[model samples]
Target: MTEVQTLEAPSARRPSASKAPRTTKSTANLGEGFAARVLSVLSEHQRIALRLRHGEGLSPEQVAARMKLPQGVTDRLLADAERTLQAARRAFVEALVENAASRD
Candidate 1:
C-alpha cells in the first residue's frame, strides 16, 4: 500500500523515486506517521478508490469500471478522498508542531 501510494502521490512520494530528492530520516519518519494516520481515517471504499485510482495509476473510467460505480461517482469519490487526506495531513502537521512547541 505504501509503495502504491508513492506511485501517484507526488508530495508523499517515496525517497526511492528518482524524480524526488532523497528524504532525511526524520522527514521520512514524519511522513510515515502521517500516512498511517491518513489510512486510519479512510473508509474501506475510499481506500479502495485511492488504491485503484492512484496506486494503479488508473483513469477515472477504469476505476469506475473496476469499482462498479459510475464515472461521475468515481470522480467525486476520488475528489472526496483527496480532500479527506489533505485535511488529515494539515491536522497531522499541526499536531507535530504543537508537540514540538510543547517539548521546547
Candidate 2:
C-alpha cells in the first residue's frame, strides 16, 4: 500500500484587543453636541422659527399665522435660519474632520 500524506491547516490568529481601534462616542451623542452648539449661536428669532416649523411640524403659513407675521416675513426668517443652520453644520463637520486628522 502506498503511504498516505496529510497536511494540517494552520490555526487562525485573533486580532489583539489592545490593537483594535477605540470608539469614543456614538453619532447620536455627536449630533446632540452639535445641536447644543448650534442653539448657543442661534438668535432668539431663529430658534423660535426652527421650533415652530420643525418641533411643532407647522407649515410656513401656519407658522406665520401663529406668529401673527406676514407670510413673506416668516419665509425670510425661515430662510435665514436655514442658512445659519447649514453654515453651522458645515463648520461642525469641518471641525470634526480636522480633529480626526489631527489625531491620526
Candidate 3:
C-alpha cells in the first residue's frame, strides 16, 4: 500500500511595502538668519558641499558623487566652509555682546 502525503502552504500575509524615503531638513529650531549667515560665508560650491555632507547626512564619497566632484575636492570644500562659518560665528558673538552692553 502507498501512503498519501500532503504539503501545506503558509497562511500568513506578508507585510506591506515601506513608504518612500523622506529627506530630513538640516535645521531644527535654528536661530533666525543663522543658516543664511552660514551659507553666505561660503562660496557656491562650498555651500552645496556643506549642505550635502551635513544636512543630508551623506558620506564624503556620496557627497562627492552627488556634486560630480572628486572626493578630495569635496573634502576641501567642506573644510573651507567650516572655517568660514567659525569666523562668522565669532564675529557675530562679539557684535551681540557689544550691542547688549550699549543697551545697558
Predictions ranked by lDDT, top down? 1, 2, 3
For model 3, the stretches where C-alpha displacement exceeds 4 angstroms are: 1-38
What is the C-alpha local distance difference test score of each model?
Answer: 0.77, 0.75, 0.69
User: lDDT tens string, model 3, 1-104?
Assistant: 11113456688555555643222352223323665766765788987887787778789999999999999999999888777777766776576667557966
Residue-level error in angstroms, candidate 3, position 14: 51
Which candidate number has the best lDDT?
1
What local lDDT does model 2 show for residue 27? 51
Cα lDDT tens digits, model 1, 1-104, are 42423346556645557754345798679889779878878777788888997788888899999999898888888888888887876787688678667966
> What clash count does candidate 2 reach?
0
Model 2 lDDT tens row, 1-104: 01113465678565688965455677558867777877777777777877898888899999899988999988898888778777877887797778777978
Name the better of 1 and 2 by TM-score.
Answer: 2
Every model: Cα RMSD to truth: 7.0, 18.5, 20.7
Error of 1 at 78 (Å): 0.9
Q: Where does candidate 2 clash, by residue pair?
A: none
